[model samples]
Target chain A: MSEKHLQTGDALPPFGGKLRLFAMRFCPYAERSVLVLNAKNIPYDLVFINLDQKPEWIFNFSPRGAVPALEYEQGKGIFDSNVINVYLDEKYPEVPLQAADPLRRAQDKLIVENFSAAQSAYYTAAFNAQALQPSHLENYHKGLELLQKELETRGTKFLHGDQAGLVDYTLWPFLERFEALPLLGKSEYAIDKSKYDILLTYMESMKQVPAVKTYYLSADMHAKFTESRVKGDPNYNMLDSSAEVCCFRPRKKKE
Target chain B: MSEKHLQTGDALPPFGGKLRLFAMRFCPYAERSVLVLNAKNIPYDLVFINLDQKPEWIFNFSPRGAVPALEYEQGKGIFDSNVINVYLDEKYPEVPLQAADPLRRAQDKLIVENFSAAQSAYYTAAFNAQALQPSHLENYHKGLELLQKELETRGTKFLHGDQAGLVDYTLWPFLERFEALPLLGKSEYAIDKSKYDILLTYMESMKQVPAVKTYYLSADMHAKFTESRVKGDPNYNMLDSSAEVCCFRPRKKKE
Candidate 1:
C-alpha cells in the first residue's frame, strides 16, 4: 500500500477483483476500517486519497468524497467508517468482531458514543486551538476515566474478552492518535501512566496486535503530520519514500 | 401508555418484569424504538417522560437523560434511538425487522444517514425559522426525491418490502412530523403529492402499519404541540383525558 494520496485528475487504478478501501493515510476514521479488515484477514486494496484535493472518482465510491468508502464490488461502494466496519464484520462472519448478545452490542456502541466527546476535543485542541476550553479538557479526561473504569469492570486482557474485537478496533485509532496530543503541546491531553495504568497497558497490548502494528504511526510521526495539517497545507505524502527520491539525489552525490 | 409525561417529582415506577422504554411523547428518536417494539410485538412498558422537566430517575436509565432509553433488564439501560432499535430487532429476532442481507442493511442505514439533513432542515424551519435557508428547502426536497427514487428502484410496497421494517419505522417518525411543517406555516416544507408521488404512496402505506397506527399523531396535533413547544410552554399532557376531567366539571353541570 503506497502512502501517496491520489488527488484530483489522478486516474483510478484498475480493479483487481479484491475488496478496495478508499482512505486517507492519516485519517482516524479510515484507519478504523483498515484495522477491522486486517483483523478479519480480508484481502483488500487500500487507495489513499488526498481529502483536500479529492479525486473525482472518489465521489463514485463515496457520495461526499469521504475516505473509508469500501468498493465491495468493482463500482459499488459503502461509505462511513461504522457502516463499512459493521458490514465487513457481518459479511465475513468467519471472524466475528461483534458480541453475539444483542444487548452487549448496544453497550459496545455506547462506549464508542461516550468516547466521541474526547475525539472532538482532540480535534479542537489540535487544529483549532482558539476554540479550546477548560470544558474540552474536562470532557477529554472524563472520556479516558470512563474507558479505564469500563476496562476494570470488564476485567479482560482486551475489551473483547481475550481477543480485540470491533469495539477495540473502532476506538484504537483514536487512542493511538491521543498519544500525539502531548507531543503537539497539548500536555493536558496526555494519558498519564499513574492515572491510566490499566488503559495504558491495554493500549500497549493493542499496539502489539498484528493488525495495529502493521499500520501504527509513532507519536512523533503523528505530531509532525499534525503540525503540517495545522499549517493549512497537509503533508499527505510525508511517508512516501518514492516522493523522497528527488530530494535524496543531492544527498547521494554529497555522500 | 399515558400521554402524560412524568416530571421531576414523579416516583420510580416499579419494574413489571418486561422491557421498558423511557421516551417523550413527541420525540422522533423515541418513536423509532416505539415503532420497532410495536412491530416486533414485544411485551414492553412505555414510560413517557417530560423532556423539559425530566424525572430525576431518567438519568439512571440514560446517562444524559435522553429519551428512547431502554431498560432491557432490571436497572440495566441502553440509550440512543438507533442503538435501542437495533438491540430490540436483534434481541427479538423472531420478528426480524432488518434485511437478511448485510449489504442491504448497510444500504438501509445509508438512506437514513442521507435523509438526516432534511430532518435537520425541518428542525430549523419549525423552531429556528431565522436560520432557515433556501439550501434547507432544497435538501428537504432532495431527501424526498431520493426516497421516491429509491422506492421506484426497489418497487416494494414499503422500504422494507411488503411489510414496514426497521428502515421504514426509523424514518416514518420524521415523515409524520414533516406533514405538520405546512400546518405550522412552513408551506415550503410540504411533501407535495406531485413531486413525491411514490414517496407519498409509501407514506400512506406506512401509516396503516400496526406499529405506526398505534403511536402516530396527525399533522394538526403535531402542529399544536409544536406551537406549544415554540411558545416556551409545552403542553405535554394535552392528550391525557383524565387530566381534562377537571375542566369538564362545569360543562358537565351545564349538560
Candidate 2:
C-alpha cells in the first residue's frame, strides 16, 4: 500500500513553470480565476477538467470537489477561485489585480463574496427549469435583487470604486455568465444597461482591459463542455462541468 | 456619498499596523488565518467579533461580513479567511503555511479542500438539527465516514509529509471541535476514538505543537458563537471553514 507524497525535500519547479487552470468556461467560479489570468499576463496550460465523472486525482487533489482549481508549479494548487484570484494577484504583481490600499481590498472582497454567494438564487431558479427539480430559486432571486440594488448603487465602471481592482476582476467574469442567462423570464435580473449603466459599461470596459481582452475560451473547449460523456471515466468531471452543473441540476438521461 | 475606498486613491488606515486578527477561537475559518499568525508569529490584537450581533463595521467594511478578516492598520483590511490565510503565509514567511514544492502544494490543497468541505457537511448536520430543520444527515455522515476512511490510509504524523504543514494546520483545529462536541443523542455520529487511532494520536500530538498549544479562543467570543445569530453574519461566510449555523428561529414575546 504505497502512499503518494509531494517531496519538499527535492528540487523546486522553475519560476516560469506550467500553470494549469482546471475549469469550465460558463462556470462563474472558474471564470473568476480566468478573469485574473486575463487581468494578469500569466501564460497557463488550460486543462478543461471533466467535472461530472471527476478524475480520482482531482477529487484526490481538491478536497472541496469544486472547479476553478489551479496547479501552480512553485506552490500548492489553489482550490477556491476566490483564493486563486488573490494568489494570482500576489504571485504575479506585474499587472496588479487587487487595489493597492487595504480598505478597498475589503470592499473588493465584499463584492467578490457577493458575486460568488449572493447570486445563487438566480442560478437555482433557472438552473434545471428544463429538469424541474426546484433548485434554490426564491433564495437565488432574493440574492440577485439585493445585487441588482447594489449594482444600482455602485453605478460605477467596476464593483469597487470607478476602476476595476481586485474585486472587479474577482467578480465580473462570473457576472458575464449572469448576463447571458435568462433570469426567470424576468427580462433580466441585474445589468440592464438602463439602470445599471455602469455595470454594463464596466463589463464592456473589462473586455478592453488588455489582458482581460485577450482572455480566450477555445471553441473545442466550449464544445467539450456541452457534450455528454461516457460514464465512470475520471475525466467525467471536466465534461460534467460542460452540462452547466453548478447553476442547475441534470435532466433525465437522453434529455 | 462619502464612500471609503482603499486602493485607487484612498489612504491606508493607521490603526492595527502591528497586525490585528478579527477571529473567534472555535471558528475553523478564523483558525486558517490564526494558523498563519501562529506559524508566522505575527503579534496581533485579537478583536473577537460578535458573530450574532456582528458589529456593523464588519458588514459595512466587509461586504460578505465576517471575522478572520485581517487589519494591518486602521486603513487596510483583508477579507475571506481562506485568502487571508494564503496572504499571511506569503507576507510573513518565517514559517510558511504552504508547501514549497508545487505538486505537494496541489496535493495539500486537495486534502485541505476535502477535509474543510466535509467538516461543512458535518456542521450542517449538527446545526441543521439544532435549528430543528431537515438536513443532509446521511450525506453529511457519509462525508465523515469517508474522512475517517481517508485518515486510516493517510500517514501517521501529518497529511502529505512528516511535520505539520499548511494542510495540517488548516484542518487540525476544525477536527478538534467535532471531537469535543456533546454528540447529543447520536452516539454513532460521535467520532469513535478507537476507530481512528492514528487521527486521535495525531490530534493529541498536534496539541503539543507550539502553534497548537499557544492557540487560544477568548471566552467572551465563545458565548457569541454557541448562541443564535450565526446565520448569514459577515463573520461566518459558512464557506471558509467546514461551517454550519444554528439558531432558535425568532421567538414571539409574551407582551
Candidate 3:
C-alpha cells in the first residue's frame, strides 16, 4: 500500500494471503491492473517497485521484471497487464468486468489495440521531446478521433455500457496520464474540450468512479513526475508522505 | 482455396455466409488462426492477400491490412490472431481449445509472452542476418530450453493436454519455421535432438495432429520461401501449384 517503490536489495514482503500486484507508482500499464482490481472490488495488496532499479524478487513475479505482474498464488505470478486483468476478471467473476458476449470482448480488445499509436505518441512527446514529430501528433489526434467515433457509435455512458468494464478500465490509465501532456508544454497533445466533449465527459465520469477516485492523480502531479523522470532522477517516492497520511488518517477518524 | 496472394487490383471475394479469414501464406500469425479453424472443424473461407500490394477491401476487414483478420459476420471483422482465436473458441464451444482453469489459461499466455524473444531472434536471423548477434542466438536457445522444460513438466502430448490446443497452435507456427534457420546457415538456431529430445518428440506429435498435418510445410519449402522473402520479392504464390492440385485432386477422386 506504500507509494514508496522498493528498489534493489529490498526484502520481498511476506505474502499476506491476499492477491499481490507488482507495480510502479507511475506506470500506465501497472495502473491498468490496479484500476481493474479496484473496479472488481477484489481484495489485493499493492507492492510498488522501482522499475529503474528493480528489486531482485520482481523477476520471480514477472520474468521480465515489468510492472503489473500479479502474484495470484504464493510464489506463482502472471505478468502483462492484459493477461493479469483478464485472469483477475475470470477468476473473480463476482463482479465481471468484461462483456459476456465473445464478439463484444474481441471488439473491446481491438479498441485497445487501435489506441496504442496514441500511447506511443504520448511517450515520445513526454520523455523524448526531440523525437516528437508532426506525424506523431497527427496519429495522436487520429487515435482520439477513432475513440470519439467509437463512443458515438456505441452511444454509452462508458465504452463498457452502463458500467465501466475492462475496456474502460484498460484505457482510463492512459487517458488519465494524457492530461499531463498539456501541462508539460505539449499543448498539441491536449484533448480540446470543443473537439472531445463526449470524451471529456466520459473521463470526468471515470474520475468520479469510486475505484479510480481512490488512486487518481491530478495532471499537475503527473506533470511533476514527468519532469522528474525527464531529468533522469525520477522522484518515485514523492507521494509517500501523502500516502502515509491517507492510510492512517482514516483509521484515526474511526478511532 | 487458392494459395495465390490477391493483390490491389483483385476483387473482394463474395462472402459465402461462412466465417472468412484474411491471411498471408507465409505469415506465422495467419497460420495460427488457420490451424485453430482446422482444429475446430470450422468451415471457413481463407483469403490470402499480398501484404505489399494489399487489396483495398483488406482494410475493411483489417484496418491496418494485417493478416489473420476474421470476418465473422458479413461485413464486421475482428483483427488480431489472439482476439479472433479466443472469439472462435468461445463462439463455438463444442470444441474448446483452452483450459477450463483460468490460472492455466494465464500460464499458457505467459508462455507465449516469454517466448517472444526467440520469435524476434528468428525474425532477425531470417530477414536481417547482418543485425543478428550472439545475444539473439542465446535468447533463441533460451526460449527453446524454456519450452522443452515446459513440455517435460507438463508431460502432455501437446501444450494443451492430450490434444493440441490454442497454446500449441499458437507456438507451432514459429517452431515449424525454426527448422529453416539451420538451412539458412544459422545452425545455432537449430533445435538439437540430443538437447531437446522431449521437445523433438512433442514437435513430431504436433506435426501429426490433423489440423497441422493439412497445412504443415516441410523445412525445404519454408527455407525456399525465406530465401524469396530475403531477396526482397517474397514468392507468396510459390505453393499455388501444389494447393491447386490438392484441392481439385480430392474432388476428382470422389467423382
Candidate 4:
C-alpha cells in the first residue's frame, strides 16, 4: 500500500505505512477512488479485489461486500464511496471539496447527492430490462438530460466549478454509462457521441487528469472479470460502450 | 441554523457559524450527529425538527426533502444522512469513528456497511407493502435473524464492543422498531422484546444518553410523530402509502 512501491506487481511486500486502494476496475464505486487519488496526485498502491471470489482481507474490510475501499496507513478504512471521497479531500485539504464561501461548498454536496442516492432511479432503469422499453428510456434520458442541464447552467468546467473538485472527479467515472442505456433499445434523446458534446468534453478533460489516467481507463488492470451476462462478445465490455452498447453489464463498464 | 439558536427556527445566519442538529424523536441519523458531536463534544445546537409538515426553512436547506442535515454555520452545510455522519466524525476527530486501533475502525465501517446498506432489503420488507406478502416477510425475517445471530458473539454492550459507539447509535432507533415490530405483527422471529434481552438492555441504555433522551426521543415526539404511527386511530397520510397508520417512522432509519 506504499506510494513508493506503486502497482508494479513486485514482491508485494506489506504496505509500509502508505495509502492503499481496494478496488476492482469494473465497479463504478471503486473507480471513484482511483479517480480521486489520481486527481490529487496522491500516490497509493492498488490492491485488486475479486468480487466473485473475494479476497479474505476485503470481507472484514468491505462490510457491504463492494469494492473501492481505502486503507490509509495500515487500517484507517473508510467505506461508502462518498465518505471516502470527502475523507480524502478533508484529510488532505490541499485538494479541498468545499469553497471559501459556505454556500458554494454546500452546493458541492448537492452535486454528490445526485450521483449517489438520487441517481438510484437512473441506475435502476439502466440495470433493469426497462431500459429497452420506450417510455422507460425517456425517463433515463430525462434523468441524464436533467444532469446535463444542471451542469451546463450552474456547474463548472468540472462539477464544482473551474477546477475538477471532489464531486466532479467522484461522479465523472460513473457517468460513463449515460449513453449505454439507449443501446439496450432506443431513446428519444440520443447521446451516443453527438447530443452531449459538453458532457463528452467534460469526460475527456476529467480523464486527462494525470491521476485519473494513471488509475482507470489505462491502469493495465490484472484481470478483467466478465459476469455471465457479459460473456465473450467483443461488442460487450469494450471501453467504448458509452458510445455503443446500451445494455452493458457491470463487467462491461470495466472494459 | 445557529448553534446559539437551534430552537430559534431561523436559518443559520450566513456568517459561517456552528453545526445545529434539528432532529425529531426516534431519528437514528440525527442520533448519529448527536453522538458524534457529544463524543467530539463539539459545541452544537440540538433542536427538535418538526417532521409533521416539515418546517419551510428545512426545505430551503435540504431540497431532497429529508432531515438529519447539519446546516453548518461554522463549516459548509452538509445534507444526506450518511455523508454528514462521516463528515462530522472525520472533521472533529476527538472521538474518531475509527477506534484507537486501525483495524477496529475498519471493522466498524464494516458494521455500518452491512447493517446500513444490506439491511435495506429488510427495511423494505418490513415497511413496504411487500412486507405484507408472505415471501417478502420471509426474506425480511431471514435478514433480521442473520443480524441477530451476528450480534450474539460480537463484543460487550454495543455492536463493536463495550463502547456504545457510532455504529451502535446509528442503528438504535430503527432496531427499536424491531422491538416494536414483533409487537405489531406477531412474527415468529422479528424482534421479540423478551427473546433478545441484550438488545433490549442496550436500547434502554442508549435512550439514556443525554443527547438521545433530550433531543431525539423527547416528550412531545410521541405526540408529534410516533403516536400517529403507533397510536389510537391517528390520521394516516393515505397519499404516501409508505406512511402507515402505525405509530412509527423512527426518523426514516435512513432509506
Candidate number of the best TM-score: 1
Stretches of model 3 off by over 4 angstroms after superposition: A242-255, B242-255
Using DockQ as the measure, what is the rank order of every candidate, best first?
A: 1, 3, 4, 2
Model 3, position B231: C-alpha lDDT score: 73
DockQ of 3: 0.76
TM-score ranking of the models: 1, 3, 4, 2
The interface RMSD value for candidate 1 stands at 0.4
lDDT of 3 by residue, A127-215 (tens): 99999889999989988998899898999999999899999999998899999999999988999999999889889999999889998
Q: Top DockQ: which candidate number?
A: 1
lDDT of 2 by residue, B169-234 (tens): 777666656643343334445555666666667767777777777774332333234333334332
Going through the candidates in order, the fraction of native interface contacts each one reproduces equals: 0.91, 0.12, 0.91, 0.12
Q: What TM-score against the true fold does each predicted structure earn?
A: 0.96, 0.61, 0.94, 0.62
Error of 2 at A129 (Å): 7.8
Candidate 2, superposed: residue stretches over 4 Å from native: A1-25, A30-110, A128-170, A181-184, A188-198, A208-255, B1-17, B58-61, B130-156, B160-163, B216-255
Q: For residues B149-182, what per-residue lDDT tens digits would candidate 1 score against the true structure?
A: 9999999999989888999999999999999999
- Evaluate model 3: give its lDDT: 0.91
Clashes of each: 0, 36, 0, 14
